[model samples]
Target: MGPAISLLPALAIAFSASQSSAQTPAPYSPAKSGFDFPIYTNHPPGNTLPNDPVRRGATTPPLHPDETRKLIQVPPGFEVRVFASEPMVVNPVAMTWDERGRLWVLELYEYPRGAKPGEKPRDRIKILEDTDADGVADKVTVFADGFNLATGLALGNGGVYLGAAPNLYFLQDTNAPAGSGAGALQKANKQTVLLTGFGLEDRHELLNGFAWGPDGWLYMTHGVFTRSKVRDAHDPDGFGVQMDAALARFHPRTKKFEVFADGTSNPWGVDWNERGDAFVSACVIQHLFHMAPGGQYNRQGGTWANPFGYVGDLPTKGLPAVVDWRHYRAAHAGICIYQGDQFPPEWRGLVMLGNIHQNALNCDRLTPLGSTYRAEKESTLLGPAGEALRAKTGATIKQGEEWRHVGPGNFLVSGDPWFRPVSVQTGPDGALWVMDWCDRYPC
Candidate 1:
């Protein structure tokens, strides 16, 4: 693990700005007429709004798993199949793989509004397995239940780390017999509140994006608007680290917590390159950032945490966004550095991100820069490219003709407007596994 660090610098930097300068931007108000929704008007120049009328009206009823699969479009030699669907898996917001190749899915049944007082928490963690070497998940086990608004999940250190607002929990199965793989999770008998005091003002902005760093520390991200004073559970009244809209890490064995980096709005996904450099996908502002320990990035709104900390008008002034341009709505989540062998050789090492607002999965080419890296937009992996063509040419492209007009690099696209790929990962089988929220409204 890395050296013990304090958030004193981050706190000072975050709050040093004047009160007037630190005020957050006005919230988005709903539309009064038509299908126009409020957009993030605070974005810097060069950022344009998406087609709101079409996007807002694009909502279609949820398609059956088979029909939805038919609407999906992938590059030649690739196919999209149903892994798990409703009644089997619902509201899968996050996913991770264990050492034994079991997929752990975090289902947020109690979203928008968390469970009411005295009510049983509905969020759950389930383990899914394709026991017969089939593409679809045939086995599902509820590893844990009774969680309220849990958004992040990771399995390691003989237990699972869960990110539910106001607390980070660690659960272990005391009923497991000697030397069992995931049998330990088959019965979540013991629960430990590792750390406490996360914010829950915005249900969507809870503590999330749990990841393990190369140095063996468990890393997580916190969103803006929600201020957190995180302290060890055993010593809640003792010294705590103040965090807001930042990246933080914890050492499980040592029970040590540190703010790794600060300044990004609602960062829901984070991953590392082969060189151990960290990248994050955020929402509303710039969608991508190269995160480093002790670094402070430009905010979506409000003044810099530290006024004297490098001030510049350009968005790329400080620890810059990996990509300069913005995509549709810039609401990005779930990122992966492609290192799997399933994709073509040209696809290796690229950055994959889910554009929830655009209803697509996008790719970025990572090129080395001095000490950092630059992300250039690549082809749309899974999106409505065919629809774009139809709009331009006034010629309807049939379902099978979607990939014909697009480049080979555009891997997958779905005609279904509800194809919200919220999270993407390289599965154990070397294929890309996508967690489609399968909903019209991402938030």
Candidate 2:
């Protein structure tokens, strides 16, 4: 519940420069030979004319679930199966399980390829269920729709919270009857846009990554190139905060939003350990931050010197990452602290992270290092049938079809390019469930 007193007058707000609709970046030109892909292009600096071709055809069909399952490599004694895929569920960007064991999936049909400036929103949040106790989802219900590039999802406070960039919406279905379907949810659901003014320049980097903290506040992430000036919906002209590449905390009942940490570069995944200590996985940087209140981490576009005059020294600026990732661009996505009893006892408290670009799942052990923490990165997912794509992992390769890159240092890298893991979580049954944003590339 919200505080009795008005907390608005004491808070400070930062309003960044506003961009007109004309300033929006142009959509991908599918007409060009090299531009037919659905994902965005991140051209390496100084290589403007390079010709990197797409492996799949311009109109490549989605992979069937049976064929897709063979391409993935799970740990020994662990079996990976297709819980759901396209035609049944498409473009699953994010997912969270409700208390009743229902999986809520966020579908972003308009990603990398976004809706035109004036185009209406075309996204939906579907509730998936497995009624017969089968491993796969057998039912789907569209709980809400008509959202502009909705990228984040979390369940708390009697509703589903959605991050649609420039707007955060809460959809509550108070009057829905038992076993409600899409139509019933649509009729009973009430849509409330709680806050607005998030960055939208880059489609991937908006107000995303929603997770409820142990402290009862909702934690969210903003990526680099974002310019957010979020204000209270109740008081439109009142105070807000200018947030860029930072962790934001919003109290649902209080309607209070504040910056949890000051600096970060496109944080994509966040979760907590058994001890309630926060850990985060950042994109491109390939590092993990152990977050604390008021702590600052790496900021992409800012310049500051440390005590030793080291400019842009991230370790000095804030808490250093538990693991630096050492320049391997894994394109980290959703992360989770293994809390289920289904996995081996050794994996009980480890942090599991998904690297979408590298097609691998990684685990790390956080060991206390005085006041801060340090991590010992464990094994990575190995490519199937003993063929690892990266040479650095050759030594850790094994002989079986399920051979994972066993590591004191090696990673598990699935040789399959279609294995794009966007979110990794401990499923209701205790097996780790991975959401494959299965596409030619991530947008």
Clash count of each predicted structure: 2, 7
Which residue pairs clash in candidate 2? 13-240, 380-411, 380-412, 381-412, 381-413, 382-405, 382-412
- Model 2 TM-score, 2 decimals: 0.79
For all predicted structures, in order, the TM-scores are: 0.80, 0.79
Q: How close is candidate 1 to the true structure, as a TM-score?
A: 0.80
415, model 1: CA deviation in Å?
Answer: 1.6
Candidate 1 residues 1-443, lDDT tens each?
A: 11110000000000000111123423322111112223233458887646564345345555555555556544444545456655666777778888777778888777767777898888899887768764456788999999988888988877889998899999899777656655356868899999998888877778888989899999888788788889998995778888878889999889999888878788877889888999988987878889988888866654444557677662545566766677656767788787777666676787777766665666777888888888776654434555545554577766654333333224445566666676767766566667776555556
Q: Report lDDT per candidate.
A: 0.68, 0.62
Q: Please give the RMSD to the true structure for each candidate, in Å.
A: 12.5, 11.8
Error of 1 at 129 (Å): 2.0
Q: Across residues 1-443, which tens digit of lDDT does each residue of candidate 2 receive?
A: 11010000000000001111223324322111112334335667654533432222123444345443444444444545445544556667777777677777787767655666786767788887768764456687888887777899987766778898778888888786655542334322688888888778877787777888899999988786777888876678966787887778899898899988766677886788888888877776646788888776666655322223234555355556777654234467777787887665766777767666555666677788887788876543322333442343444443442324434332344555655666767665576666666555544
Where is model 1 poorest over a 10-residue stretch in terms of lDDT?
5-14
